[model samples]
Target: MRGFLASSIGVTCAAALALPLTLPSSGARAVTPATQSPAQRSAESVPGSTQSLPLISFGSDRSQGGGASREQGLHQREVKPFSLVGVIWDNPDDELNGSVQVRTRASGTGTWTAWQPVETHNHEHAADPDAEERASGRIRGSTAPLWVGDSDGVEIRVRGEAAEQRSDPALHRGEAAQHSGDAVEHRASAGSPAAAGQALPAGLRLELVDPGAEPPPQGSRPKGAPEALTAETAAASAVNADLAPLGADAIPPLSKKKTESDLIAARGGPEEAAGKARPYVGPRPRIITRKGWGANEKLREKKFAYTRTVKAAFVHHSASGNNYRCSQAGSVLRSIYRYHVKSSGWRDFGYNFAVDKCGNIYEGRAGGVAKPVLGAHTLGFNTNSTGIAVLGSFGYSNPPAAAVNAIARLTAWKLGLYGANPRGSTYLRSGGGNLYTKGKNVRLHVISGHRDGFATECPGIRLYKKLGKARSTSARLQGR
Candidate 1:
């Protein structure tokens, strides 16, 4: 399957060799290609770009009892093509106590789809309160990005909930009834006043992301004196050289025996490997490296962060929606990577690994895949845990069986390296979050959902439910 994917990608790249490639630049909305001036295409195609449109206050002003009015968003309008969308604000610390919904028109068809809900509880998927990344002035409060496919037109609404209602557990979990199409239509036709609630965070902007075309598959012909790779890129790729050739597109899979042998060798001889007893570890699964995914390594901080050990693995959904093709997984990852580092101001991609719908696993962040690289995922629990985000929204949609199995395979191998039992439990000290106070040691499953560590609907409801299957399968793979 991995070979097949690589071959397919090669063919695709061959066909698109003529397309201009560039590094990411910053910007927002422009005319569509069909009507775009040459200058517009040239600007939009500069690697990739984000169009940030400020969401304005709309609907009747109903401020009451000193509460701020609600319904802050932009009406439907045309713009440049974008495959992903999210809402971002000025402050990383301030919470957006509201619901966010957006409906978009397909770029070519001009057909608008039903309004999709954007996960509003994104604070829990960030760096610890005291982490340097969190302290950075550029970090912004952002909603989980929603993958809306290729869209040229958009309409969005952000409705804030009252302060008292904000305390409700249901609302925090995003379980309030969904905004239906008919209701939106009725509200638009009747001109009904939006419900008044708390004020949203300042500087709210709708971010439209075009992940840009996938980079030419690794090892293709040189494109005009190949751009010099940055020292940061070289350092990031160096960490994975043990598992793959430097600059290789992927680390090929190995059998259980080979993996065990490599594990023993890595422990500085067989004497310290599993205390003389044969290590019970799963086969090494194929992993696409960061370079394979076209990560602009220069965007991340030069220094890599590390933890003492990986005591647990946190599973999460990108919450970037499911409107993507397996072939485009690289693009989706690039967009999220850019969003994390460039837009949200994270030090790097938050998750350590990402699994696509087709069961392919991609190495995330810059640190070596084997290292206990600290991630800005699962909020307070990131100290000793690695995060693996499955691409797409899974709140209501069923996760693909392949993706779930990929999770099992990934966790089995990754956790087994640290001698963690996939089905067992471990203690993780909280760095502080809504769920656990600072300095508290909480016992949690070795393989836990994002919600298990924080008060957010991450890894989504449907995906969270499948963690059981992942755990058992992982244990079986580890020979436990």
Candidate 2:
């Protein structure tokens, strides 16, 4: 166990130097195929990519009842082929008191789909107001991204509520406080009386994501052929080496007895190492590593931040909608990752892990999957908790049984690592949110829904209703 820790630490140090702060230009940038043999080239699949475009006002708004009720959007236009779409604005603290809708033309059919509403209440799925990440001044307000399948043309509309009028500063505390220059410029340009009623925040842009291509599956290389490793990929994969070989697609599950033995070894106390005390850890479940999903390692910040311990698990729905196939889960993940970092200004993917509709689990965010990695999810409750996002909107759609079962298996293993009971309750001091104020000690379920910690509707009603099953199953797996 000690040797495992030693090697992990060594590799982490060696790879840390290659961590990046900036993102690559808008496209997948994997190692050039020309530099590798045919086998290596085949192993390197096409990378995922994202394109960001700014949104412009539609036309004169006087024709739409009240003159103040204006709309911002793009008329029917062709763009690079993309499968997902969302909108973002400057100032993470601002609220979009409005409706956002989009319609897309199918990639090859030339037929356009009916306009769909994008989830607008997305502020609650973010870093707490006081975290260093929020203070970094890069965060942006975003609408939940929607999957549109493969599309080549699109149209969108964003119409703000016409009832209220307030100064731009009052619209966003963070922008007024930290980015006053940008705010002042916005206010000055939209100074007309009509614009004051429902003016949108500045720097609003549309994000079109092409979740590039899936990575080649494991064992695709010729027998005994060596695997290629970029420094970024190595850094992302090294943290999980304790559970799987470097660059492995997934961590193989362990038997209950093996899990207990490994848990004892990891604790490293003489008494615990002797296996005199029974550990309440569950058998590890298979988890797809970041490499398996074709994550652009260069798209995130270098260093990882962690809390002291994980006391709770917060579950969420991607809210990107349910228009994707299980085979495209990796592509969806890569798109979300790019959207989080490149489009929304987050340091990395917000959740600790993600589960596809088919129940396949994929690693989210960098850092060791076993560690207490701090995530920009479940605002006011990120500390001492891990976040898991089920990949789809579940508000109107019933969650798949396989997906719910996968959540149980995941929390059983991960929560057990910190001695947390999946069915029990715990207290987490709020870092500040709509439901709880800063420093408030709140009692919550160990396995809670995203809405339990924030005021937004997330993890949706259908998925949230199944928490009872997840908790019971998780406890049973832990042999409680």
Best by lDDT: 2
Poorest lDDT segment (10 consecutive residues) of candidate 1: 181-190
What tens-digit string does per-residue lDDT give for candidate 2 at 89-168? 88766666678999999998899999999987777888888888788788998988888888999999988765354333
Clashing pairs in 1: 22-47, 28-51, 147-320
Q: Encode model 1's per-residue lDDT on 65-177: one tens digit a residue.
A: 34444668999999999888889988776777779999999988979999889888676788998887788787998988888888899999998776656553333455222
Off by over 4 Å in 2: 1-46, 59-69, 163-197
TM-score of each: 0.82, 0.84
Full-model lDDT for every candidate: 0.75, 0.76
lDDT measured at residue 63 in model 1 versus the true structure, 0 to 100: 53
Could you give the C-alpha RMSD of every candidate to the true structure, in order shown? 12.2, 8.8
How does candidate 2 score on lDDT? 0.76
* C-alpha lDDT of residue 429 in model 2: 89
